[model samples]
Target: MDANSPTSQYASLAAHCASAFALPVARALPEQPAAVTAPWCLTVLAADIETAQLEQLAAFVSADQWRPVALDILAARADCKVVRIQLEGDIAFAAARLALLELGQSLGVELVLQAGETQRAPKLACFDMDSTLIQAEVIDELAKIAGVGDQVAEITLSAMRGELDFQQSFRKRMGLLKGFTEASLAEIAPRIPIMPGAQRLLLALRALGCKSAILSGGFTYFANYLRDNHLAVDFVHANQLEFDGGALTGNVIDPIVDGARKALLLQEIAKALDLSLDQVIAVGDGANDLPMLSLGALGIAFHAKPKVRAEAPQAIDGFGLDAALYLFGLNDRAIAALLDERT
Candidate 1:
């Protein structure tokens, strides 16, 4: 095909995106370029930014040779500021992203860098329910109710930090909850604080016709509760906590949804949805979440631990879940419009 032909043009675009983002060239290219055109995106967030901070950001951008094509405010909240910048020229997206990270650190702000099929949102977004979607860990809460909080919490922390096997720690923790009444779960479920910005994230994803799933090592009851009542997520894959006569049996159903299982479930969901793995996004904050995170085209460590943040391809520690929308190329205005339509 001629260099200017449609095929060649698409190939060139794909090559540029791959080179910029450090993604595999073949995997970076979408099946239909008309539907998904990649673009560079920079999102700046913080609890607050001063005039000095803004001037610093501007100076940094101007000094860089990338030469942004457009700059717009995506959202400006009392505690946060999201900016969308489109760039021109042969830019190294990864290097620019690193520079932004350094800048954000210096300013005590959060900067997120995303470059890929900006026009195409992930078909499915899989989340780790406990810490990522909600503010508490169900197991630890259950342990607290059962008067084994300290013991179970130690194990839970070890498991999450990758010091112990998840399955083993899970069983040990469940053992501590033995004899607790199922009614305790009902009480705790309602009280589990949903993560800030979760509702908005789900709302934006719904508007984009993207399905959501909860792939958690937590119990089915809480996952289903969030999916049905809180987030309206499409699917949930979690371990079933076995109960007898409305009391905890200290056992879970076979085939615990460990890290490996989480990855497999992501693939299964993608296959079932008729989408590629590249069309999936996974978010989590623990060691067990690494498998699923690594499998997705876009994997984020959300408010994660040092280990997870170090390993995950992307990390969103300083911001809330709504920042994930920026990765999909949704600006503040677009999100506001979507929220208005829903209201």
Candidate 2:
């Protein structure tokens, strides 16, 4: 590719982003420009997305006055591949995301973007426990053992959907699990289902020297089990269910790890580690996870509720949690290399 080719420019431009602003006097390119530059990047993930389809969106971008530079291949698999497009002009946030929505859906791809400055892999990542790291909501499982699964699951759904107050809903759900035996609760722990791609994702993150924490609205009982037995997490913070006489008391210890508290803990950890909030990544799938999600530099709604998907900065419902690697610009080879290096 020619040095002046629009397709030949992103790596250097991304490095000099501090000084590279918009081009003045209305710059225009030839019929076929090579690689290019941009401060904002759009990462495309799908089984296969044709260059022509992407170019159509690029043409639309050009028509709308934003410059589309180069399309770089990041990672690939037998089924899906990840690619990125470098953009130059500063388009509105929503517009940049929507640029590929229609075309992306038709092409069967998921597109996510972030400011180039913050695109480096996060040093700290916070995850919500239930329905995130694990497939089961602990309370619902306990409620079922107590013969009140329907009642608890209802409130759980309501709270996750952002309809009911989380603390109140949590207490209600716990109350229903009051009669559950200690033995039953213990049994639930070992059988808890881990989310797909969870262990690999954590191991990869650990290899990258990223600290992972579980900030759960669920009970500490379940969260601790996940931390100790399954994932490579460094910290765990969650609500505690009190037990008396070998039965759940239906009461929790103070300091419920609701949304607000999750946000506070995220900051506290960042400060203690001497890292900026911009270096943190938060991932969750419910309404109560929103606070911490909003705090991190990049918040991902991982197979989340509709409300969360709509509100969060970025969301990926098309793949497992491992798809997050693509968001950090880690292609298949990079992820494989990181996994190989993980202990």
Candidate 3:
């Protein structure tokens, strides 16, 4: 192949080495032209590839299969060759470079190549209102009036950590609020500080025609508060606390909204909106948020507890709730354009 030809360009790219890379080769000479679904095809070779090496190539954490390939020295299998790749985008040159690096670092291995790209879109944004979109937990604050703030907060922490089940844990905490008044909600609702950049993020999604919801394990009182304020959510599914004679009735309404319920609500809302599971993004910071997170297309563990972060595919450790927008590829100018539309 001439150096100026497409095959030559891909061959040159594949020859360049790094820890892991993908190279694109010219399409085969055939009677019919097939569609190039992925921008680049990668030839991966790693007799020994480590987790860190995979992360450096993929820009995300590596799962376990590639570890041994990075660590051991093995003969390149011609007949039983396999490809273990963590794809980024479909840039042929980029993939080629990544694949070359992997091959260069390994002693013996050669795998086939195919090019592809992933298009991720969130149709539904499911959120936990308390401590996720907003900074406060409604029931925890109310516990202070009943003089069980410390105990209630401890249980809240435990429940959020996945140590306790949501309904059971919430009931244990709510029992401490037997004499609390609904009036406290009025005071606390206004004081609930919205998470930084939360409003802008949601507004951006709404502007983009994305459906959103608050599938909270919290109560309807504050869920309504979010709706009445700036959330602009399409649906809200939450627990309802029963009251009597202007005082706490010490009993929750029937069908408590718990973890399993949260998952069901996410599916229900997605179905109602005619969106598939791959179009839903579930964001939360607690253990109870796991079910819905597991079910969505991209489950963001936003400033979540350590356990939640470990299990979630994506996490926002450096930024605010608004950072979640980055996973959607939105930027400052895009957000400003969105903000203007909402007005």
Candidate 4:
């Protein structure tokens, strides 16, 4: 259509929207003459469009000009504002809609064009025990008592990067922890500093009626301590140190729950809870945690290694463990209120 012609209807659409932008908005801009266009759909979004019968407006225009895209409620808004409309069929409609939607969203119109699913309901929170839920590595702590701390820590770092199989790494690390006292487990338990905001974050999840679990590559000794300290951890799966005569046997129990095993535990727990795949949140900072974390609805790299952070969809670097609560759409005030209710 020749928009410059006095009788052309395209002129009216521009004129109608002129007040909104303080400039005429049109399907084709005078400045961009050589832009290649593709067939697309136009979706309208705004409070004004609902009262105006936007569908009727689409019908008034030539079928070749534009087509109705979709109608949606604006994100996180109270009013029944007319949201995005997707247009289909013609390339001109697609180009025009994309431009307008981009512009509208930038103007704070609550417009989301081509956005992916951003939120998921969670029923369980899974954590990697060592260097994740707790700052100290249970194996390394044991190794220190054995006087092999430096040797074991190197292997631990390699295994956490996925370079060595977790089973092999745990076997080698456990050999070093051999002959440590059972009393040492008790000693390390209380000294194990939790990652920042760990307790508060777990408490928040519990208050939300969500279950928590630890699927660790570390030993079960420290895992038990986590549960005893008022953290509502529902499950603890880790390597069992083979002990005989009240001393380490330099072996682990069979069927060690390593990286692959941890992934299985996540699926099992989710199934046992009757929660969908999209209703689980997994957090960890090491290579072993990657498998389950990737499967979770909300996989978070919590102050993670570089590789973990690169693979994770969401990551928390600066904030405390409690900062992850933000992913649930809660602000500081809302979190404080939830914490307040518990007190």
Per-residue lDDT for 1-343 in model 1, tens only?
A: 6854434543544443333333334322222222223265555666554556656765676677555544444444445555445555565755765677667778887766666454357889999998999998888787877889999988867875678898889888888888989888888888999998898898889988999999999889999998878896999999998889999999878799999999999999999999898889999998889999987768889999867866776778877898887677665556767677531
lDDT of 4 by residue, 59-160 (tens): 433344644433222111122122223334444423443454444444433222221222322688999888778877777777877889899989977875
lDDT of 2 at 107: 60
What's every prediction's RMSD, in angstroms?
10.4, 7.8, 12.5, 14.3
At residue 186, give the lDDT of candidate 2. 80
lDDT of each: 0.74, 0.74, 0.60, 0.61
- Candidate 3 residue runs with Cα over 4 Å from true position: 1-121, 154-164, 341-343
TM-score of candidate 3 on Cα atoms, chains taken together: 0.66
Model 1, stretches more than 4 Å misplaced? 1-39, 50-67, 88-100, 157-163, 341-343
* Sliding window of 10 residues with minimal summed lDDT for model 3: 67-76
Report the C-alpha lDDT of model 2 over 233-283, residue by residue, as the tens digit. 999999987889998888878888989999999999999999999999999
Superposed model 4: Cα runs more than 4 Å off: 1-121, 157-163, 341-343
Selected candidate, larger TM-score, 1 vs 2: 2
On lDDT, who's better, 2 or 3? Answer: 2
TM-score of 4: 0.65
In angstroms, the error of model 4 at 74 is 19
lDDT of 3 by residue, 14-127 (tens): 333223333332222222212324333233333333334433543321331121211111111222111233234423433443444344335343332322221223678899
